[model samples]
Target: MLDKLSLVVTAPEIVLLVMACVIALVDLGVKSRLRGLTYWLTLGTLAVVAFAAADMAMDGRTFYAFGRMVVSDPMGNWLKCFAAIAMMITLVYGRPYAADREMLRGGEMFTLALFALLGMFVMISASNFLVIYLGLELMTLSSYALVALRRDNEVATEAAMKYFVLGAMASGFLLYGMSMLYGATGSLDIDEVFAAIGSGRINHQVLVFGLVFIVAGLGFKLGAAPFHMWIPDVYHGAPTAITLMIGSAPELAAFAIAIRLLVEGMIPLAIDWQQMLMVLSVASLLVGNLAAIAQSNLKRMLAYSTIAQMGFVVLGLSAGVVNGTTANAQFAYSASMFYIVTYVLTTLGAFGIILLLAREGFESDEIADLAGLNQRSPLYAGIMAVCMFSLAGVPPLVGFYAKLLVLQALVASGQALYIGLAIFAVIASLIGAFYYLRVVKVMYFDSPITATTVSAPADVRAVLSLNGALVLILGILPGGLMALCAEAVVRTLAT
Candidate 1:
């Protein structure tokens, strides 16, 4: 039997695993096509898990369990809480959309989502290389299945195939990188790897070679440029609801693993990895913003926007260590965290409107589809406009502050190159803004395509309103969440 300390440390994972299984079994008995029973149970489970994670984060205790393969810390706990909430919101917005298309036939969506959240929990808590890989596989596998949930749809099936092929290749890159690190360091534990690399006895060439593959793998997961080939296709082809599921919450997990692998385990080689990140950031910004300008499909455009946003996150990460000094590590990493959280929040609302507009047989996935949206339903158009403005980094909205924080992190480094990078990022943002604002133009200025008023269920309506409000409210008063991020990062580094 496991000791009480281990159980307490892993309480959230235990709950998630058990409840996911129970929900799966309970869903077998669910007769409603909407799976109302399974849906409420999954929501209840997520709420409990979120509360537990938040409580743990507030407790401010760090524990290593399962032979130190896993850790429970404030940073991981906070991410878990946010991921759970993100999943909840995703389901709330997605269920109706999924049901309308008969994708809920087997009642697998709820169970698969629960399992995916469990994978995220594992990823956030991982302290060992093997554990991280395990978590990643679990999450990606569930996502592939979800992407293909509509078996009769060729587009979803094709998307699933592309996602699986690219995802598997990336995973191989990551695993091989881990193997190289283990061969050099003689340990799979993250802290042990740190100590081994810092001892200065290992072959620098091998470490750098391994670092290249590791960064490449992470870039793929983060949807950074060059390795972002799969994103546009997958996002455009997958069911919109599945697209949001794969796009949003999993990003938080990717951020967690990047911190674990690069910051915690490979900080001794910061100069090398930071340079790699800088190149990736610049490339991502250039490719993403430039390509997004030519896209007509809304989902494909958002997919490219995602790559550009990740460039900013990577830019903040690269600024964390300069001249072998980690003085700004907390601030830089916290800014990246803040940026990702806000990005996910805004993406949720943006996609929520898309899901809402999708009726029984309409896809509503074109920029032209949103023409004169303001005339159809002012509330949804207003929400989508808020999301678009936020994505464009317009002032008095969360995205503006998110960009400001990342750029501030870069400038705080006090290096000419980083300052130049900051300027370049500003240019990229300006170029990117055109596409985001284009959506607003279509919605408000263009002629209406249909006189039918857009409508959504009460839950989706209430949640979307709250989501839009939070984007604006958080921008006006950003200190609370900023402080929370700072504290979480500081505590994780302390341990």
Candidate 2:
């Protein structure tokens, strides 16, 4: 039996689970005004979990918990740490928006956020299809509730409906894929499945079909082109706080799942899936960049940008090639992971600024709404500029390094055609820059529409400033995080 008492292997999950239950119980017993307590408690839980993950990384163990499930290897530990940090930052950015709108006391949202974190923990460590599905469902269900948290808002209601419908369909696809793989491999364990493929015991047709379905399901989750019809509408309709969570946490989870499925479980089938990802990557880049240029709503623009970023990650993954004896895939996989981290940080920072600028009645979602921001608040404008430039992949910014790594990985893999496509993507990026820069130009160059000062709550302003600074700092010193990402992917591929 799997011992539940191991701290080194289970500390992060156990701490989060215990805190989630405590917060739910305390929320029920406490007064309505005291609901903010749950939020802080949730953040504290994540902090502890993150620290525990870091410690586990230091120890460097791969398998834990009676070897039935759960692993605390560098890969899972690092990804979980990143997910935890992202959750805490999101809570910091979300608190003021919830409070200003009298929505602070929603203990369910806080609890659900913790549950989603738990899902992320399970996702990164999952050794079997059952664990992966369980983790994915836990995260998806919690998100559905979060998106619909503002029950009175019709847009929220509609968006929740769309998310629920599409999310459920995606889950079905994942399940069907799992079933096919199990039939062909005769095992649910990822290691066993990989062994079957490596030994040529698995039927080729079944493996390819199952993989296609799995890719399709994950593509929906990542909001890649041709599967991204729901992103903009949902981003526009969901509350800013909920959008922040969706934009950051879920994207990380999707990336983790992709790494687990493609890099770990299906490495033997690289030639088949890499081509599929390449086509999807190119489509996502073209569609996301072109579509985003027309968006006036800031949240929608970011949603489309998220699609573009996913394309870049896919581009890296698709650069993998099979050699005679071993797969030459490490560079692409590492590049994809690094891009995910950078994209998550940049997107969250941009959305954090949106949450900061939003007032009680005004949402700060529209681009025209940011006109003359510099005159009203130069500090906020400057922070927003950093986010904008970073998103545009400008030099000396983290986003630039991320894109550079991805293109370099593709070129090194001898995929020169993909390199050409990436160059075209750079042009698309410049075209996409016009919209992001339009926001910056309005902030720094335009005249103020009103004389009233744009004031954010103290906590909101602090987080926004820190988030913006971190993006620039990471851009300047990306080597450390990039090295960590390389280590994680190397460890995963080693297995």
Maximum-lDDT candidate: 1
Residue pairs with colliding backbones in model 1 are none
- In order, candidate lDDTs are 0.94, 0.82
**Candidate closest to the true structure, highest TM-score:** 1
lDDT of 1 at 29: 83
For residue 306, model 1's alpha carbon misses the true position, in angstroms, by 0.4
lDDT of 1 at 327: 99
Regions of model 1 farther than 4 Å from truth: none
Q: What's the number of clashes in each of the models? A: 0, 0
For every model shown, what is its TM-score relative to the native structure? 0.99, 0.96
TM-score of 2: 0.96
Candidate 2 lDDT by residue in tens digits, 1-495: 656534557778878888899999988866755366776778788888888888777666576563545556787788788899999988888877776666655588789999988988888778788888999999989999989988878999999999999999999998899889999999888877888899996679989999999989888988998888889989999999899898887777788878778767887898888888888888898888888889989999888888887899888887766443234577777888888888888888888778877863689898877888888888888888898998888989998999899888867755567678678777778778887888898787777767788787677777778888888998999999888888777776676
